[model samples]
Target chain A: MKKVIVHVTLKEGVLDPQGQTIETSLHSLGFTEVEEVRTGKTIELLLDNHDNVEARVQDMCTKLLANPVIEDYRVNVEEAVQS
Target chain B: MKKVIVHVTLKEGVLDPQGQTIETSLHSLGFTEVEEVRTGKTIELLLDNHDNVEARVQDMCTKLLANPVIEDYRVNVEEAVQS
Candidate 1:
């Protein structure tokens, strides 16, 4: 099996209210050293063995997993050990 | 500076409706080889240099970034290269 990990993060310069909230909350919680925080999505998929897995996974990210206009996504494909 | 990455994922056996929906959607999009899907959060933080950075990041995860009851979190700390 193939294990694919897609990280979808907001593009730089985009406003991230959720991240701002988290940063403020962290400071209030006594983590004062925190300068910035950004939150994103991690999508993991288990797939049957197939050719062009990375390309196909990228297609999935573009088609559904990520918003290309406001987000950037990175795809990493790994071979899952047989159990 | 320090860069910390916290990956918060649902524990095994926890029902992930969102993942299921994504999997179904991928299949409908013709990526039928996808067998399973899981979703999680990727939190990236920038922090001023401090003592025991990993421990502090772990504390942040426990107190805010992750729900210890149903989620597992992993932290990776890296030294930010001076630019």
Candidate 2:
């Protein structure tokens, strides 16, 4: 099986309110060195094959996993070990 | 500045509830080929330098970004293109 990891994040120039909230919360919890924080989403897909998985996963990202206008995605593929 | 992207996901063999939700939602929305889906989190940090950043970021992942036992993380570092 092929395992693909997908990372979905807001474009660098976009603002992230959820990240801001986490930063402030961290500061309150005594983590003072945090300069900035941006939060996103991670997804993993287990497929029987890797061939053409990239295009399908990208389609998944655009169609439902992410808000394409403000967010971007990176996908990494690894071959899963067989038992 | 150093930009680090952290991907946190459920360890292999662990069940993912959120991913199942998304998969079902997608099926309802007309996507039928999706086999399985697993979901996690992504975090981006912009640091002034790379020195000692990995340790700090890993600490951040352990302390705040992810749950140690059930979740695993992989970090990628990239130099931001300065304008």
Candidate 3:
């Protein structure tokens, strides 16, 4: 099977309240060296073999997994591996 | 500054309803070759320079970003880069 890992993160100018909260909490916990914290999501897909897998997975990201207006996604494909 | 990428994925056998929903949606959208889909979170932390960064971030993951009993987290530390 083919496994694809997608990393989805918010755009540069977007406000990430959750991240900010985490930052403050981190400082409170004594790790005060934080500059910024951005939170995002990772999606792993196990697929039946297909042609043009990367392009197809990117299509899925563009269409459903990410919001193009506010987020950008990176795709990492783990070629067919023994499972 | 340093950037740490934390990938948090559910332990095997944990029920992932959101991932299941996404898999179904993908098939409906004409990409029916999917076998399984797992969803998780990625936390990007832009941190101030400090010693033992990886250990600190892993601590952050176990304490806040991930549920230790149900999730496994991987940490990637990007050494200070000119930014």
Evaluated at residue A25, the lDDT of candidate 3 is 91
- Collision pairs in model 1: none
- C-alpha DockQ of every model: 0.91, 0.51, 0.84
Question: Who wins the DockQ comparison?
Answer: 1
Q: Report how far residue A74 has shifted in candidate 2, in Å.
A: 3.2
Best by TM-score: 1
Cα lDDT of model 3 by residue, B6-69, tens digit? 8889999999999999999999999998889999997889988888899889888877878999
DockQ-based ranking: 1, 3, 2
The lDDT for every candidate, in the order shown, is: 0.93, 0.78, 0.90
Could you give candidate 1's per-residue lDDT for residues A14-68 as a string of tens digits?
9889999999999999999999999999999999988889999989988999999
- Give RMSD to native, each candidate: 1.3, 3.1, 1.4
Docking quality tier of model 2: medium
Better of 1 and 3 by TM-score: 1
Which residue pairs come into collision in candidate 2? Answer: none
Query: Global CA lDDT of candidate 2, please?
Result: 0.78
Could you tell me the lDDT of residue B82 within candidate 2? Answer: 46
Residue A23, model 1, lDDT: 99
lDDT tens string, model 3, A1-83?
Answer: 89999989999999999999989998898878888889999899998888899999999998899999999899999978666
Candidate 2: regions farther than 4 A off: A29-31, A77-83, B29-32, B80-83
